[model samples]
Target: MPRFAANLSMMYTEHDFLDRFAAAAADGFQAVEYLFPYAYDATELRRRLDDHGLKQVLFNAPPGDWESGERGIAALPGREAEFRSGIDRALEYARALGCPRVHVMAGLVQPDAKPAEHRDTYLANLARAAEQAAAAGVDILVEPINGRDMPGYFLNRQADAHAVVQDVGASNLKVQLDLYHCQIVEGDLTATLRRDLPTGRVGHLQIAGVPDRHEPDRGELDVSHLFGVVDELGYDGWMGCEYRPRAGTSEGLGWLNDYQGENA
Candidate 1:
């Protein structure tokens, strides 16, 4: 069976950020992921992870001015400096936590900007981020978010994310394939994974129920079957549970229970 990581940012919202680590552990998760760790002291976060015996699997680099509505700055023109600074900050946390992968969000595209301009800025920023990440023995990931959830997100299509990874041409740069978003933008989950995983460009995987973004068990997508495909494809990376729980986080884990039984 594939290993799963709880997304503390989305799951375990019932508890404070620091408390979620223990909650996840108590609920049977061996690993965890979150949206951003910049708000908390890295040492404290690491201490909690150690206390809970949970590995930090993934998290995103800072999204610029989140309160002001900037999802990210990497793809926005003229914010290259800020983007690099965000990357450096992320590396600091990754180094402290021993997390291997960091996802860089591509900021929203402005109405006035051309697609080519945004793409160019994104590639340039990622190339630099990749170099920095490699030096720290870490990998950088770019995810294609569904525009419906994040309107104006620069990278929205699976093909587009793959193309950017190719254009960046860095060994440490890869795609963070979120199945929820992929299902919305591109329906052929099996085919897409089959094509992308073999190329070794996939860095990490995330899953949630489609249309509702809830726990994987109740959606249009057969998440368990998809896990089977991932196993068949020989993907050993962490798969993040990046979904909002319809009930409580632990209460909605029946899907994982079912999955574990099938695999066991």
Candidate 2:
């Protein structure tokens, strides 16, 4: 069976972080991922994970500029220092929360940016970051967010992410296959995953329905079918539920219950 992990950051906002985590536990998830947990106390997060008996599968490196539209700078020229500092902070959180993977997002692309230059910069920085993460035994996962969702983003294709991973040539660096974005950008989910999943290119996974980007039911993705396909592919990683709730996270969770019950 494919392991299912709820992304608490998207799954809850009504309660405190720990409470939201407890809810995921009570709902029967064995692992969870979050987008940004650096602002919270690492010790507290560690305690909560321990209490809930949940594993931390993935999270993201800190954004360079949360405001003014700058997201991440891992591939930006002249920003290596900031990117490394961000990785250091993420390593601390990964240690505290027992996280095994961290996604390094290449932030927005400049309007006149050259692809070759950006790709070279991304490969160099990712190689160094992967070395640091490898020393800690944590995988550095790079993700390709869809251009439709994240306008101006530099890396927005699974092929691009896979190429960067190959260029870095580090065992610790791999691609995070996010199905929601993949469906948007490529549409042929099964074929794409089949091609990349074998290269050991995929380090982590995230999914949700496309179009509205909500729970599986609100869009075209047959998430249960997806789970089955990946399961057959022998992927033993967490499938992160990284979607915005239509109304609330709790309500959206019914989608999982429906799929799990049927697929169970």
Candidate 3:
């Protein structure tokens, strides 16, 4: 059976973080993922997870300056110090939350930042971050946000993200292939996963139906097909439901049950 993780940050934001986690456990998610949890008390969050018996599948690097629309700063030039500080903070939080993976958000580019310079800056900083995370037994996962959803952000493709991991030369660094973004930027999920799995490039996964960005069901891509393909390929990782619910998250969860069977 494919283990499911609720995206509490987005799907359950209406409630407090701990309360949302309890709700997710009540709804049957064995694990969970989210975009960010910097403001929440890490130890308190851990206590909630312990109470609910939930594993944190994934979470992101500290998003810098949310008011300015700067989602992440790890890739921006002239901000190496800030970026490292962010990584450290994320590691502290990850440890408290018992998380094994951290999604490095390649931040939006500056108006004058050259493409080549930006790439080099991101690679260098990620290498350092990966080295730090490696000692902590955590994998630094790079996420490629689709251009449509996040314009001007560097690193926006699975192939490109894989390349970053290769360039970093840090075994602990890997790629986070979000299916929703992949569908928009590049379809053929099965083929991509097959190609990337052997390299250990795929460290984490997220799913949402295309176009609407809702739960997977009667959508452009078949999540169960992708799940079966990954299972056959011997991939053992949590598939996180990171979609915005069309009505309620629980309503859409029936799709997964129908495809995965009640046994799952």
The number of the candidate with the highest TM-score is 1
Residues 105-124, candidate 1: write the lDDT tens digits. Answer: 98888677799888888899
lDDT of 2 by residue, 148-217 (tens): 8799898888898888888789999999999999988888999997898888889888888788878866
Candidate 1 Cα errors over 4 Å, as ranges: none
Tens digit of per-residue lDDT, candidate 3, span 134-159: 88899998888888888888877888
Give the C-alpha miss distance for residue 3 in model 3, angstroms. 1.8
**Whole-model lDDT for model 3 versus the true structure?**
0.84
TM-score of each: 0.98, 0.96, 0.95
> Stretches of candidate 3 above 4 Å error?
110-112, 262-264
Question: Least lDDT summed over 10 consecutive residues: which range in candidate 1?
Answer: 110-119
Error of 3 at 145 (Å): 1.2
Total backbone clashes of model 1?
A: 0
Model 1 C-alpha lDDT versus the unseen true structure = 0.92
Q: In terms of TM-score, how similar is model 2 to the real structure? A: 0.96
Superposed by TM-score, candidate 2 places the C-alpha of residue 178 at a distance from the truth, in angstroms, of 0.5
